[model samples]
Target: MRYLTGYSEAVRAQMQAIHARQGLGRLLLARYPAPHGMRTDRALHAFVTELKTEHLRRAPPIDKVLYDSKLQVVQHALGLHTAISRKQGARLKASREIRIASVFKDVPHDFLQMIVVHELAHLKERDHDRAFYQLCESMEPRYHQLELDLRLYLTHLEATGERLWSGSGSSGAHAGADPQPAAGGRL
Candidate 1:
């Protein structure tokens, strides 16, 4: 339905079947594994910092990074970037802040990376046109795929009233981390 609008009919049918299953939550949990616990503001700041260092080295530094519970995904966003200007003595200075949805605290690492890369790209390109997406891809090569997967994830959440990784930490298809106890596979 609402979340599947961008997908083709065939894809929607398949996903709907998945959604209609007795324990869609279990299926999703099997796929996504566990949510991450970059729960603290400091941890989030460090995480964003690493992404910036890896991809946007020449871009302006971010003054702050936070995971805000006030950010709701159904509102059509997973992250936000803001430019703030202030008066310092006689001059005006600017800084940027990035806020990710607190809901991301428990998703897979790749999804977090996608959101971080997206917000970071805004520092360079202010529009959601071709150039902005190009920049996003430059930052994360698998950007498009991860984004689609994340959308499917959101669809699952909306349909099931479930949190995919409601239990422990991230341990999924992502390579580095060891597999966690299933929310029962690796989203």
Candidate 2:
């Protein structure tokens, strides 16, 4: 979906033309190479390792992780809320399994890892509470800090209309994706 970034004049012009043609703005874009000095990537990898070793107890086999360049809704951390029902599973001859889905179209790696670790934790802890936070924290010591950072970044994007997280806005801004209050964000 062509996501827009208010970075360059060209980006805005393209967004304008696309918006003029189509009623809705574009959202997803292809995966561009990771930027130089992507310390975030290293941090994210460490976070994932922590999740595997400390929090999850056992590592859940990841089936597939696709980093789509095109997807709207900014960063919809989609995943199986719960395992498939027994009846449905029997119908599909599938095991009672849960899944995780995250969109990196425009999300930073650290933020993306936060969302992923959050979802993966759900596989172990069904409810969000002390146990959940404990698990999340065990994996990522600065769990709340990272979350706040991501929220601030999103607020910045909303205020300036510049794409947040990803330089290439493949997915357009997602609605209600940001739960944190945007105190200084746009009206």
Candidate 3:
């Protein structure tokens, strides 16, 4: 219920629909395949970089991108986009960075794309205004849907304490709510 909290009635209804589907017969995630070939930070960077090159060509380049273990989805922050600016002597040096919750490592690629695009959009737009959302939509056409479905995925995780897609692999990995991998990540 906490995971489903903060959502509107319509979204909660949608989540119930998905939950019913998950319960009546099979897990809803079965219908959505997990992302493959991106289990490591390096692979994830390459994936994000490709997306950046494709849509946000003129946006500021990302200085750092990593799967942060400290990013807990329970706090409602699936991803973070930050510009660390510090003045050294007379010039201000800033680095744009993106941090994705490690919980997403096992989610579907659509969900991952949604979060990544959301963060990437921050490079150009600081606020979640019209232009910010427009940029998110431009990067990921199904941004809203994927976000809702991702919420459903989190709700499922909360209710069942099962990760539909586990770290070992989608086929054989047993479900575990916490799949905390290593701390240090490759760029």
Which one is best on lDDT? 1
RMSD after CA superposition, every candidate: 8.2, 10.8, 8.3
Error (Å) of candidate 2 at residue 5 is 25
lDDT of 3 by residue, 137-180 (tens): 78877776665556566666666667776745222212222222
- Where does model 3 exceed 4 Å of error? 1-11, 17-27, 73-76, 167-187
Q: Ten-residue segment with the worst summed lDDT in candidate 2?
A: 23-32
**CA lDDT of 156 in candidate 1?**
60
Off by over 4 Å in 1: 22-27, 73-76, 168-187
- How do all the candidates rank in terms of lDDT, highest first? 1, 3, 2
Q: How do the residues 54-147 of candidate 1 rate in per-residue lDDT, one tens digit apiece? A: 8889999999999877666333467889999999999989989998887788788888888888889989988776788788888888777666
> Where's the lowest-lDDT run of ten residues in candidate 1?
177-186
- lDDT by residue (31-128, candidate 2, tens digit) is 21232232343443454455556656665543333333322343453333334433564474323332323333355555666666676677678776
The candidate that wins on TM-score is 1
Query: lDDT for every model?
Result: 0.70, 0.45, 0.67
